[model samples]
Target chain A: MMPAAVAEPMNTGTPLDKDASQADLLRSARFRMEREAHWRRLDALVTRAEKGGIISLSYDETRDLVEQYRQAMNSLSVARDISLDRALVAYLESLCSRAYLVVYAPQESLGGLMGRLLTRGIPQAVRRSALPLFIGFLALLLGMAAGYRLFIEDASWFYTFVPPDLADMRTPEASANYLRSTIYGDERHEGSRLAAFSSSLFSHNTRIAILIFALGIFLAVPSFVLTFYNGLVLGAFFGMFAQKGLGYDLFAWLSIHGVTELAAIAIACAGGARLGLAILLPGRRTRRAALRHEAHDAVKLVILAGLMLIAAAFIEGFLRQLVQSPILRLTIGWGMGLFWLGWLLFSGREKKIRRGRS
Target chain B: MTKKRTRKSGPRIEQFVPPEGVPVNFTIATLGSRLGAQLLDLIITYLIVFICAAGLFYGGMLPVEAETVLIVLLAFLFRIPYYIISELVWNGRTLGKRIAGIRVININGRRLTPHQVTARNLMKEVEFFTPLTMVFAAAAMSNWGIALLLAWVLAITIVPLANRRRQRLGDMVAGTLVVNNPRSVLLPDLVVASAASVPEAEMFDFLPEHLDIYGTYELQTLEEVLRDPARRAVTAEIESIARAIVRKIGYTDPVKSGQELAFLSAFYKAQREHLEKLRLFGTRREDKFHHAEGANADTAADPVKS
Candidate 1:
């Protein structure tokens, strides 16, 4: 008996023309017969690779696999173009894509990834964002100056600039003792108090940074406002403390954690502003393209900023309340500030080493 | 007649052709499935945090304050590492994506990079989680905060809806797509033998021109029509479809109404062979659109030429 053909007619319609149908059947049968071995071989190789990664294959096997993949892709293109068999075309398409991913996908080690990100990714992103960072700083400074001028001129300006819930230390009419207590906290319960403070501060700062970065898609206005508003609150509190003759103490207290905290916020704002600039002034690129290009750096900046906030939270929680000496606080604050500056500047620089032969 | 024309002309499947010439056929995942995957991931994350918190509480090793601090930090920072590590390890599929049978792929055809994974997952913090936080924050503040938060949520939600690719804000920003991973099995040759014994090819004869009129895409559609048991039961519908195909291909010989299905079956077999032969020669046709529109017109003018 002849091989029962898969394409058997559904019903007893008009008898098919035997000669033409037999010839067509022979062509299809021959086509499948010729290609079946290679197709089966490719399928087995792919299945094995999928089950136990490409690494399981030997070098020669891997080379042979790639050659098979190329031949299969050619088969798929040809099958798609000329073959009328849907099932055949579908099978080839699936095989080719799976092989493509297996052969072409990249694999990297964790240590290598960390090294590249640290050495090249974050630093380059930061450097690229210098202009936006500067703009963020300027906006903050302007807000601070405005708040200071307004508060010094009229005490009522304090209410406008600083929300009452957030104004823990420098509330109007608070005595010096109360102000000092707010900063140092109850000395006996310092550990728990600082932990709570740090957690809350971290959450607050991280949330704000994320918001600024997220809002940057809207042309940066909201980011600018939030940054300026943060500066205004800082200035209002400063003015209040100076008015109460605790200006030096306030500066000493803030310096320990404020440098890092402020820097993180500024960087976040800068990241947001960068996104805004991309949308507003896309240069030669389309708006979408510009936004996509800048978004990568902006996201990196936000990640860096988030890390900085975490560090600031650690310092604010553990170190700030425990240390009482104003001079020590000053020293630690300046040291951390300088350290960050130096790290940012020199961390990723490539150095050429000179060697002399004996 | 209208039904046949509509079935023949309508695009049956979605195809994304990348600019980089190599045809990668990926099925874009629906938003509902993607959201379902995210929901699963969210539940898993919460469960992890809950288990850790319970363990810390029962262990009694640390002070309450320290335990609370640890739990809070874990809750906040856990998602970042969870997403980054999973995607990097599993090649753009988290446990959630894996379970849902979807994967994140670089839309531009390059290998998924660590940077792209990190960027997309980090944006999720802003796009999804932070907005919920903002809503809570808004409840504490004036109406302006609520308005702002609502707008932010709406903006992110609308992005995926507006795009044909169904790319979320994170996907657009990161240049990735979530596609249903193709799952196919080796199929027996459709033209292989079956139980029914009908004459193989005498019902119809297709000229080269008739075979050339349609590419593999249309061929697949035609195969689907022939395979449908429901359509086969309705002889009137099948006859109409066969007639429409004949008309479109400009067959010169009139097909008897009774012979329409048989003609289609024979044409299917012949066209499959013709296409396979063409493929062996290294020439390819992507779909009907890939061929110049005028070729069918030229073939129609010279009906007997094939």
Candidate 2:
């Protein structure tokens, strides 16, 4: 266990200390003398970065900061290896961490991040959960079919399926003409409280989407149920409209934004479902690691969902009111739906090939 | 892992080995300190929410719809972003953490990313706020519901206790760590004053045979005794210790009257050089009583040849 350096002198350099402790101190003192300037410069730069952020530094300073940071990091390792001066080591540790914070911090700027997320991040995430996304889509479709059947058998079943707040004017007892006017908005909602209700509804929908995704972490049952329940409400509304032979008109009206809106919620639910299933079947990874790994993609999908919802809200608020023709409305609805489907499916697949080749 | 917590109540040391292969050590923030920081953050966030709510309800400056929207917005807009943005912009410190001298760092020794910050903060909604609200909201509803809510809250509360790193669910999921900020001061170099540093005295020297009698423990004791600020008035104490060391080591040198300090300094320097040359470091030595064991540790502590 013992080194024989004690029996034989391993004093390779300058001389032994007037003996050892002083010589060792002299070595560290010399170490400090050689590198103290860089540490001091880095400290000042880091203090400035902390106060104002990386943006405040000049280009030259940021460059210098990185060079000095690496120098400090190197000094830290050397100090640990040879020096026993705890205080010097501690100072170097603090300096390196501070400088590391500045240097390795998220390097993408806001606009850059946005561009990447929209172009690659969202689509890639949505693409990864293709199976869950399809399952979510099927859940909504099945719920719609179930609601339509239940309402056709008995109009009174609407109350059981559709909550009052969302039911609005499309009641079973309401006249066909009145229902038509509400769908087409015959000067009723315009110049009125449209702004208030529209914003409120937008916020409500987005909150529900986020909640669906958040609740997915617990095994995705809640998310799936909520998505199904929402589908039922929509189907029940369509069923009531069909009773008056305005089914086609209602489809057109809903399609203007419903395609985007429904799909967004389904995507969000799919994100949650991914998280939920990750907990149950984490595969080879630890449960925590699997969940975290899935969560990264899931979060990207959530962001995509929120953005799509906003896009849907704009269409619902504007195009849904202005457009009267069912044919054109259906076209716009299906067109937007296909756009998202194609984008999510194919947008980022060739990202590697397209990148750096140019 | 925490064998490094040598004192009964010392801060735990966590080491991170970055890709550069330099393993740096950081002092993990204590649980009590983290709780304090959380409490401060909660207070700060609540104040912000309270201020915004007050302005919305009492300001009487906006239309009814706008006020309602803003009041609702306070929950979404302020509290969540306060934690996220502060951590992101301040490089892993919220105002509370900055004040408490702690920071969130990536466990891998990388810089904190926005995604990491965002993930951890978002989990706060699920981990802390939701459980807390469930307890308060369900308390009046049913005994069963209250019990379930409390259990949920309790489970999350004990998560940090489950690991040596004190990571909560959020921290685990996000791969971040909260550590005590490094102590930040470069101390002056540690060198025993040679006779040249003082006026009118030349140095004393000791041979390896004379130096080898003492180990690191005694060297440290000698160092403290000589470096003590009040040594000026304790000349007799210094002289006695010097004479005792000379007698023990059997050094054949005679100390001039006032030069006991010089003799001890040289012996101290020589003894440390001897111990370090053997690579006996970092509390591996006690005193001359265990010179044999110290010798064993010296070879063990030395690095193997590459």
Candidate 3:
């Protein structure tokens, strides 16, 4: 099975057999001897590169290493074509495989990659995800309406929509005055306590956003449901305040930071949706192939959302209560939204335009 | 005595076209090995977590509330991002993978970028731990909802088995492949000790009848013996194999007691020389049983009819 040619009954005593066999042996042996040093050299360089990275090799050696790999690959092809010793063939194959990882793998610094992903990769991915983002945004709005209607029909639905710790004094039981007081919060604890609260919220939001993205790998419906459910919780809180004639007041309280925060969540879910939709509609490509580019795009969306959440948390922590006027709060919130919309659409366009022109 | 003869165990090889466009064969890491590597990583992570908790509990330096918070935060910090940091720093190898002699690589032969590494490792959170969280969450749910959760976990578990690539969810999303890091040295040529070069070495002469009885597999086995480092130290294996070849080929020449390895070297050269001649005739004798040279003849047709 390893042979490249047909099999025949041997034992021909012709004198030509010995000379031919001798020539073949010399040819194979000489073939190995001529390149054995280079193969061995490649083996050593690859080992060092793998263990200590490409920096382990000097400039001349690095250049020599590629040449050695090319030569070894040539030897492997020759050996296979001529059908040399099995062990020799295996050795060459192994040496080449090991060398390939070191020789051809990405050798660029990771810092530059991060810089690129942030300024360009993130926006490019976000702009490409307009449909999924819209779908996610629609789901959240639909959930908000459903949650508000449910809460009005039965105040007991409040507990199901919001966690007890987060609900704090905003529950159905709390008086309107107390609910307003909690919204403005206590200015006395605005130093460390507020900072701690902001950091915790930031981490929680980031964690939830990432989870939505990860769960999207399943088919995207989970991410959609989760995003909708998140909106429901917010709606329930809004409804509880509105029932007490504090709806406008609470909108001002929440909107100061809610716009960016909510959009971040929706964007994160859209990232996950990118993956789920790929599986749902792989088109001409296999699900795996379709996922290849989408998964990366999804990660960028998640990271962008994460960065937004950080900004939202800082605004929520420091600025929301400081600016008490309802008009100013809504203005700040809408301004952040406009800023993001502009950034995502326009950040990475110039490079593409220049490239096209060139 | 019919000794156990093991054939060359061919592992799963995938052809990767590197940047230079040469198709190189990479031996894919098997599922068992990957599982073992993950298990090692989990064990190592938990050990650290356990050690931290035990120290904190015994120290009694902080209040129980503070201690609890610290323990939970420490475990989360260590367990979640451990894989990403480990793989990124080691350039696709965690300590566990390094120990297991396997490493992750980009499927399309590109460098494993940080984005791919981060996304894949983050996926470990979903694939492995989601079920644990789901168990508690589903406990309050109705029966059908619980069943749905179980089905989701089962589907995730089966993804690796769905393909020959053995890609789990993380690998699928990240576009990475795991392969065994092969290690080998090009040993000296087994044909160097032929009769033309060293008379003392090639003491055993192989007639066409003797050479034709075995083929490449047997020749390679003979080469293994000749090149074996312990061939001189442990005479039994070398003697037995040499004796088997001599008896099978009807090699009448007496092999000197100390020269069993040398005798193997000589027969190895002659057999290879005969096979090479056969190769020139476009007739490669694959093994002793390769005489079924026409259609419907498989490698399993080991009649041993000789």
Candidate 4:
């Protein structure tokens, strides 16, 4: 295959042809010469490929050819000292050197998009990678439950760890009332209209979610420690009901929406952690270069997380209420995750430009 | 199809020759190569810190705070020099890049100049600011000022990725090139039967560096072989010998086609035959050698006519 040499128009030098009118002669002659030169490079590439006994030259060769080809085009002259064929050959050789760059060329930009998804709204309508959410959801379910068992089970001292209002809500009677209000979406405030239970939960959950995103950026380690800590607290919170024989009811109440919400939080952690790793490691770039490289990828992970949060919010508001079927809730959550995964792998209109060889 | 007068006096432009430069290994730009160098720098900094700490603890010399400050200062001090020296001395690579088969060079395949090295390294500040803003935002959340700073940093970070050549702020300023350091692979000769009646290009005892003279001689010999039927069978043999000799003399680019080699072989034989005739006709050895080996072979004095 002939490698394409990206050419820029020449500003200096004699045009290949001298006979045409002076005004347009340089432009027209240069164009004609460049076109011919381009073709010649293609021929040379084919010959080099045959001689080298390789189907294609390495990416390095392709890149070099592109630069050389462009330069040769710019340096075109009417000296007749060099043939068009030689110029083309030199250009193609340069292009063959750069062919490998095409492979990793888009990684930085793609990472950027992923970062945006984790931090901002990625529109549930938009497609996203499913693996991260699935992993996150699974971790939240298993990890939080385990952490709660180890840190919060049957420990009266746990009350001292939380605020009085939150600790008071852990009592059996308060838990039952909270569950009833969450399931029916019918709890009313004692004072203002804004004091509806659903609105209160919404405001509180949004604040926590925002906190998670913000914390993730400082350094990945602290955010990670905090995420696991939250999981432990959530586990202990639910364990109180389990000990009272209300475990199944508690599961049904939280699992309806926690699947998506917790997954988003985990992904956000991963994004921030990625940035921290970039700083600690930096590899071949300076600390600054390494950070920039990692930030690009971390930002993309965060963007994906944001989309998951939006999905979680919808489930929390709508499905958490009037949907007592644990089986149906699990199925719907899993289905949404699958759809997101499929979309991420297959979104966007990818343009494939295949040039026909002469 | 424009009507034009064909001038008999004018030489054929298609036959005009051009000079070729020394061949060089082409390089590929890669993040892996770029990243590997960064890792090496970090390791060096850490190692230096370890050494200083060890000296203070074991030798009982430097104070604890002094050692701590020294470590901090060392890490900061190495950043700019590490980037510039490695890029200039080793071509965008450190020990790791050298091991990974990558090097930094100019886009023109030349060594990076000092000015180009300085320009690229100084721009490291931009890349630093990109994530620094994010760190500030995350650490001091709820501060609108921090978020604004983060946004400013993000804007600077995006510029390098948006441009072609995948250059970051530093790369744009430096004009240095990061390229693949390919394995040192030597091209084997496409051998043929050695020249006999025609004097070998190597036998001329001229410096091998003069490839243009040799290339044109071979081209002329190929024309002669095509014109004469007797030389056709040995044409490939002659061309191969000439090619091997030309390449040995550091004519980096060689004719890839077997046919082109054959043509070059014939051109060499014809030129040698012409030289032999001049020698036989009582021509001066110096004049004959000049006619045989120098530029403008076609315009050389024809001894037969004299």
Interface RMSD of each: 5.6, 6.0, 5.9, 20.8
lDDT of 3 by residue, A52-150 (tens): 889988999899998999988888877765544777888998988888878777443566777787678888888778888997788789889989999
Q: Model 3: how far is A344 from its true place, Å? A: 1.9
Displacement of residue B298 (Cα, Å) in model 2 is 9.2
User: Would you give the TM-score of chain B in model 4?
Assistant: 0.46
Predicted candidate 4 versus true structure: per-residue lDDT over B178-288, tens digit per residue: 665432211211111212222232223222123223333343334444434465566566566666655644544444454444435433433333333333344322221
Clashes of each: 12, 2, 0, 54
Q: Model 3: which residue pairs collide?
A: none
Query: What shift in Å separates residue B24 of candidate 3 from its native position after superposition?
Result: 1.3
- Taking the tens digit of each residue's C-alpha lDDT, what string does model 2 give over A97-209? 66766666533254577788878888888877888898678778888988899999988889999878778866898999999888787865452245455555566677678
User: All models: lDDT?
Assistant: 0.73, 0.73, 0.78, 0.46
Point out where model 3 deviates above 4 Å: A1-27, A81-86, A163-170, A187-199, A316-332, A352-358, B1-9, B18-22, B43-90, B132-146, B187-201, B221-247, B253-266, B295-306
| Local accuracy of candidate 4 as per-residue lDDT tens digits, A1-358 | 2111101111223222323422322222234444545535544553464234232677876665555544443444321222222222333333333222221111112235344342232432122324433433444556576656654445663453345676555553465656444434464323222223333344345334434433433444455665766676677667666665566766666666776667667776665455456556668888655655454444455556655665676566556555667677667766676766565555442411121231
Over the stretch B1-306, how does candidate 1's per-residue lDDT look in tens digits? 232444464322334443334575767788888998888888888899999999999999988888888888777766566787888887888888888988888877567877678767767876888776677677587778778778888888999989878888678667888887666566655554311233534556666777777766677777787776688678999888888888888998778767777677777766665555555554454456545544654444343222
Off by over 4 Å in 1: A1-33, A36-56, A154-165, A168-170, A190-200, A350-358, B1-22, B55-62, B135-143, B193-222, B225-306
Better candidate number, 2 or 3, judged by lDDT? 3
Identify the candidate with maximal TM-score: 3
Q: Is the docking of candidate 2 incorrect, acceptable, medium or high quality?
A: acceptable
Using lDDT as the measure, name the better of candidate 1 and candidate 3. Answer: 3
How do these models rank on TM-score, best leading? Answer: 3, 1, 2, 4
Per-residue CA lDDT of candidate 2, range B164-242, in tens? 8898877866778999876467665434344345322224555656765665557766766766659845889988988
